[model samples]
Target: MLANLLLEIGGSMSTLGAGIGAGLAVIGAGVGISGVGGRAMEAMARQPEIFGKLQTAMIIAAALVEGAALFAIVVCLLIAGNA
Candidate 1:
């Protein structure tokens, strides 16, 4: 009975951990994207002639951050499922 209780508790903890990890990942992605966008806009303001280049770079960077965040979220979900 004790073993079963411990197992259940451990499983619950794992699910909780996964949830926390996913939330943190999302928050990190948001911060990263916002920083990138703000910097890109500042750069464009400094030199409008290269607005296209700055925009392209910013989009690429933001996409990469998003991809990583998605991957992290998926991993968390997988862990939650397994637990």
Candidate 2:
């Protein structure tokens, strides 16, 4: 029916979209953390004396990025639940 086509009922597209978004957030977070770790290690290798400071800074940066990603994932989950 035209109405059925125009107005979707029991649609799962929103849920699917939200799920995809959440997955992307997690993937992005993983990539960000990996980059941070790799770069921090590379910097430390270049200058071994500053390893402690570099490591501490890297941890803080990674935690902030991860926290943001977690927030995004939680929001996506809530949206999925609502859908």
Candidate 3:
């Protein structure tokens, strides 16, 4: 009985770990996007004439980061599923 309980607890802990990892990954992505936004804002403020180009570039960069983050999340989900 004790062994079975321990097994179940260990499995649950691993699942929790996977979820936490995914959450942290998302948080990191959010921080990265925020940084991009901040820099874009600064650039636009400094050179109002280039607002259009800066905005476009910033958005593309954010999208790429988000895509990578999503890939990590998918991997985490797969791990959780296996656990």
Ranking by TM-score: 1, 3, 2
Model 3 lDDT, full chain set: 0.93
Candidates ranked by lDDT, best first? 1, 3, 2
Give the residue spans of candidate 3 off by over 4 A: none
Tell me the deviation in Å of residue 3 in model 3: 3.5
Determine which window of 10 residues in candidate 3 has minimal summed lDDT. 74-83
The local lDDT score (0 to 100) that residue 29 gets in candidate 2 is: 96
Colliding pairs, model 3: none
Error of 3 at 83 (Å): 1.0
Candidate 2 at 79: error in angstroms? 0.4
Model 1 steric clash pairs = none
Candidate 2 accuracy as lDDT: 0.89
Clashes of each: 0, 0, 0
lDDT, candidate 2, at 2: 78
- Which of candidates 2 and 3 reaches a greater TM-score? 3
Candidate 2 residues 12-67, lDDT tens each?
Answer: 77778888999999999999999999999899889999988998999999999899
Candidate 3, residues 11-83: lDDT per residue as tens digits? 8988999899899999999999999999888888899999888888998999999999999999889988988
